[model samples]
Target chain A: MPRLSADQRHCVRLTLNGRAVEGEAEPRMLLTDFLRHVIGATGTHVGCEHGVCGACTIEIDGALARACLTLAVQADGTSVRTVEGLAPEPGRLSVLQAAFRRHHALQCGFCTPGILMSLDHYLRSHPLPTETDVREFLGGHLCRCTGYVPIIAAALDAAERLRNGETDA
Target chain B: MKPARFDYVRADSLAEVHDVLAAECGEAAVIAGGQSLVPLLSMRMARPKVVLDIMRIPELAGISLDGDTIRVGAAVRQAELLAWSQLKARQPLLALTLPWVGHAQTRARGTVCGSVALADPSAEIPLTLLALRGEVELSTKAGRRRVAAEDFFQGLMSTARADDELIEAIRFPCGRPGEGHAFREFARRHGDFAIVACAAVADGKGVRLAVGGVADRPVARTFAGLGGSMLGQALDAFAHELEAREDLHATAAYRRELVRQLGRQVIEEARRCRA
Candidate 1:
């Protein structure tokens, strides 16, 4: 029953990457901007604020969503996961991240964070994925660098490693 | 690009939504998935004075079978609807077209009714609905009414929904015992908007074909057991009747050609399975 007016900022609270965080944002603020500028978790990159590029992809309440397409106030009371949450520990690479490193999946790393979030969520639900499935899922993302072949290789390799019970590298 | 400033409201009940909507009149935009609306907002193409988030309303969030109709709630995400166990069995047309609605990432959050509300000329859902003879349930504070899919879409990116009305649900009829349905789309990328999309439904007596991305709105026509070159002629007439225009992705001639070629393929596929 609360109407958060556009001209004023309101306190928006949500769980971010396992930690409870709150930020003040106007009703027009995008989740991506709130995450980077207000909460200071810049791991989630923003590209094509209109949601074409998947650089702004993240998990909202365990569902894959484009941060650029979601409003900050709409995320209130929900739990969000970003690329910063992918690692098991500081300085430790998750299996998917390790595979990307091994395959040299990234060139400039501008799109790596969002790609990691997507592959991480996808491989969890579909533990055993075919090469074609990986390619189809990757269609959501646009990577100008590496031409996506290495990214596909890394995703498949990570799926194999995870299926074999390897947690980290 | 950043969106123009707008007020926000998280409504927990239909009454609250109706109140704000009725008060704001035409200046309020309802956000349910934000997949299509968000882009319009960021581009400043649609600058609503206030955005009412309707997903929080518990009543608007489910899919159920009411007799032969699958009533899909406004809050039901596209992925959730596709994952319904009874989907492919009951509504094969939707099961086939839902995957082509958007990418897995976008479908994970985009709602089925949101796509209907957006009413893109080339959207798979609208075309499929019209092909299936589905209906859209629109509601306001006073009451609700059902509009047949054919009447719901007025033109490109337009619908008959009033300013105070919210799309409560969409009713997709369950497939009949002996009917057959098929869908085909051509897009440069898998998730991009289609250059041309077709949906066909065939019965023992006749076949209904719906074409999108060619005109102001999706167009459906019925053909009665036309064979070979006759069917081709009907398709040619439909293609030319659409007055296909040249866009950056395709030429008018190319779209007309697709209509001729793809049109015949869907009609053939649908008729082939009609038992």
Candidate 2:
């Protein structure tokens, strides 16, 4: 096996949910692998490995991107917020996560983490996207178990809950 | 699957990139956002001996507007293009077609030049660039050359770009006072490659329609100064002129119909934009 080497392995140091995490990786290592294997943050799931599945979605500099499709070096010096980081206050799922649970948005729960993280970031800027917006926004994700009726409902429910000043936690 | 073992070089400058490409010759590959190239690498579909990482090159990432053209750097990510407020206001056609490129996540890493250089017939940038009359700036050890979008794409995943040349930037004429454009496509599912896509631009010069995904490369038809009856016939003639290739996505006949349907729809939408 030919050992691959980088002239300089870029050292990425960024805040992973208020905590500084640093690592040195080749420019080719996928951010998904860096998080799941290297950092042991398995909450960020990897589904299609390709960008087709949003299961590996994470927040980079407050914008959503598929972890599987992005190289770890690309996130250098940029803050990364994963599904684990979304609930940083701890002891509970975020409001969006709670709405998903209350609305029975997931089954088997394989894609839940990614959905939560993506929607969490999306809703932060959008705050209120219509039902059609939810459908179109969620088009990036694929769910085989529950179809998408419940998931869409969960997003709608969360949008309403967040809008109505019902509950932050 | 892990990509095959290969040497990696994170090029810090264009001079370094040129030297690396010259050194590795045919065995080198440049990566911008890795949205498209990374997948091919991981699948082992592209086994280049040297992967030239260009993401760190500060010279290659920005979106700017000159007097009348929008210049997008080679490394400018798709998200930047979509989010650009100037483009949104000046060119809604670009904004409309931007979403169809890929998912938000993929677009974050996908570069405008990468999409054009890859020149996937089904890719949105090439087709959109064709309709917008875009130009590509390519660089090599020899010098820099600009190629019009029509001349840039030769065939499926084929371009006039040289093996050792790097695409520097893509430029398209900005908004015209009375001109309007529209883009539409049909795919099996959202985020999937289009079965057929149409991008139409109309101005005082007349109507120009560009079609992609239904053919080996994007095909354009122009009806110089056509209107009313002449416009209708021109569209039919244009539809007849696009000789599409049949593939698993759709039969040749089916794709042809999509081209016609989408062409008509996009032309109508452009007319509305004009109004």
Candidate 3:
């Protein structure tokens, strides 16, 4: 067997936020680091490098996963969606984002991007989710600020708007 | 933290995995979901020379029903199994325990066989496998063999599987009629590992109880014609048999108490459902 140097980088090509992107990273580089550094999508926050914190959440091949725990090389040929893709246009908030603002869902805003991305995918499938459903879904995410009250309110409000066929606020 | 530098080999088939493992013998690690392995790698706990990526192996992915057994492939993600309606209908205990495995994000990438392969004492998958009397299929270049769940799990982070072999699938027997099953665990948070967990299945004939997180490996006890009141006493006696040890999260005595309490609750719940 042949051995590769620790600094040797591999080429990774994938679709990010609907556009085809290519970058170079070591086999050991985490997907979170690759996205923020190589792809310049810093919106995805990295909390615990382990799988515990939901701060590094992203959609890989239409499934939610922890970017921190996933290797960049393993994501080759996959489609990824980060928090940067949530809004329709620059400087404009999506309906869910606007609801977060209206409901004052975030305080420090570190966990906001991951939460928004998670709920963006979640609300699409669960348009008429109940309070318990919303709470249970929120269990995966951790919000140190605002006591999660406003976050739940914002998620519920966004679900209502999305159900009413409102994509943009 | 980033993982240590290692060669990455993407195995498109089982043969390729075996070839790589044979060549790199004792130096290569097979990665399916990378949920558990990646964490261990990042922490420098596992520093293999080569990582054989089995996620792309088409043969190692899928969920199928063969007769009375539900076959779950090694690459079948935890969330995928949770979404399979047939699995939920066939094995209600597994369905109840899957949600408690981890958060939605982790489950999206964590594999069922990977969890069983890791054999975490507190993991829901292993405990449920024990409770359901499942069987794990392990394959090497020589051949494939099936091991019962009870004999498969050795101890904390240990299994009967050889390092050169890969887990193919796990077969779970379908739930029988008139059987009532319940799974209950006490965890600090919704997704955290349980301090002590109980999985119980009761029928008119008898009851089977499996407990995890309070022992080195999941332990089971079968009772025939045991009444509800006697079930509690049996669990109390069984609690003393566990070699529960103190960890940062809990003490041995606390875990024993948990087993006794949760054991009775799950047994009663299963009995009520049976009735």
Predicted model with the maximum lDDT: 1
Candidate order by lDDT, highest to lowest? 1, 3, 2
**Every model's DockQ, to 2 decimals?**
0.89, 0.40, 0.57
Higher-ranked by DockQ: 2 or 3: 3
lDDT of 2 by residue, A71-99 (tens): 77667678888888766367877778888
lDDT of 1 by residue, A32-108 (tens): 99999999999999988988889999999999999999999999999999999999899899999999999999999
User: Poorest 10 consecutive residues of model 3 chain A by lDDT?
Assistant: A1-10
Can you give the TM-score per candidate against the true fold? 0.99, 0.93, 0.97
Q: Model 1, which residues run further than 4 Å from truth?
A: none
- Model 3 segments more than 4 A misplaced: A1-7
Could you arrange the candidates by TM-score from highest to lowest?
1, 3, 2
Per-residue lDDT of candidate 3, residues B83-116 (tens digit) = 9978768988888899998888789899999999
Mind giving the per-residue lDDT tens digits that candidate 1 earns over B135-233? 999898999999999999999889999999999999999999889888999999888999999999999878999998988788899999899889988
RMSD of each: 1.0, 2.8, 1.7
Q: What total of clashing residue pairs does each candidate reach?
A: 0, 0, 0
Q: How do the residues A1-169 of candidate 3 rate in per-residue lDDT, one tens digit apiece?
A: 2233346888899999999999998888899999999989899999878877688889999999889888898899999999988888999999999999999999999888878888888898888988888888888888899888999999999999888888773
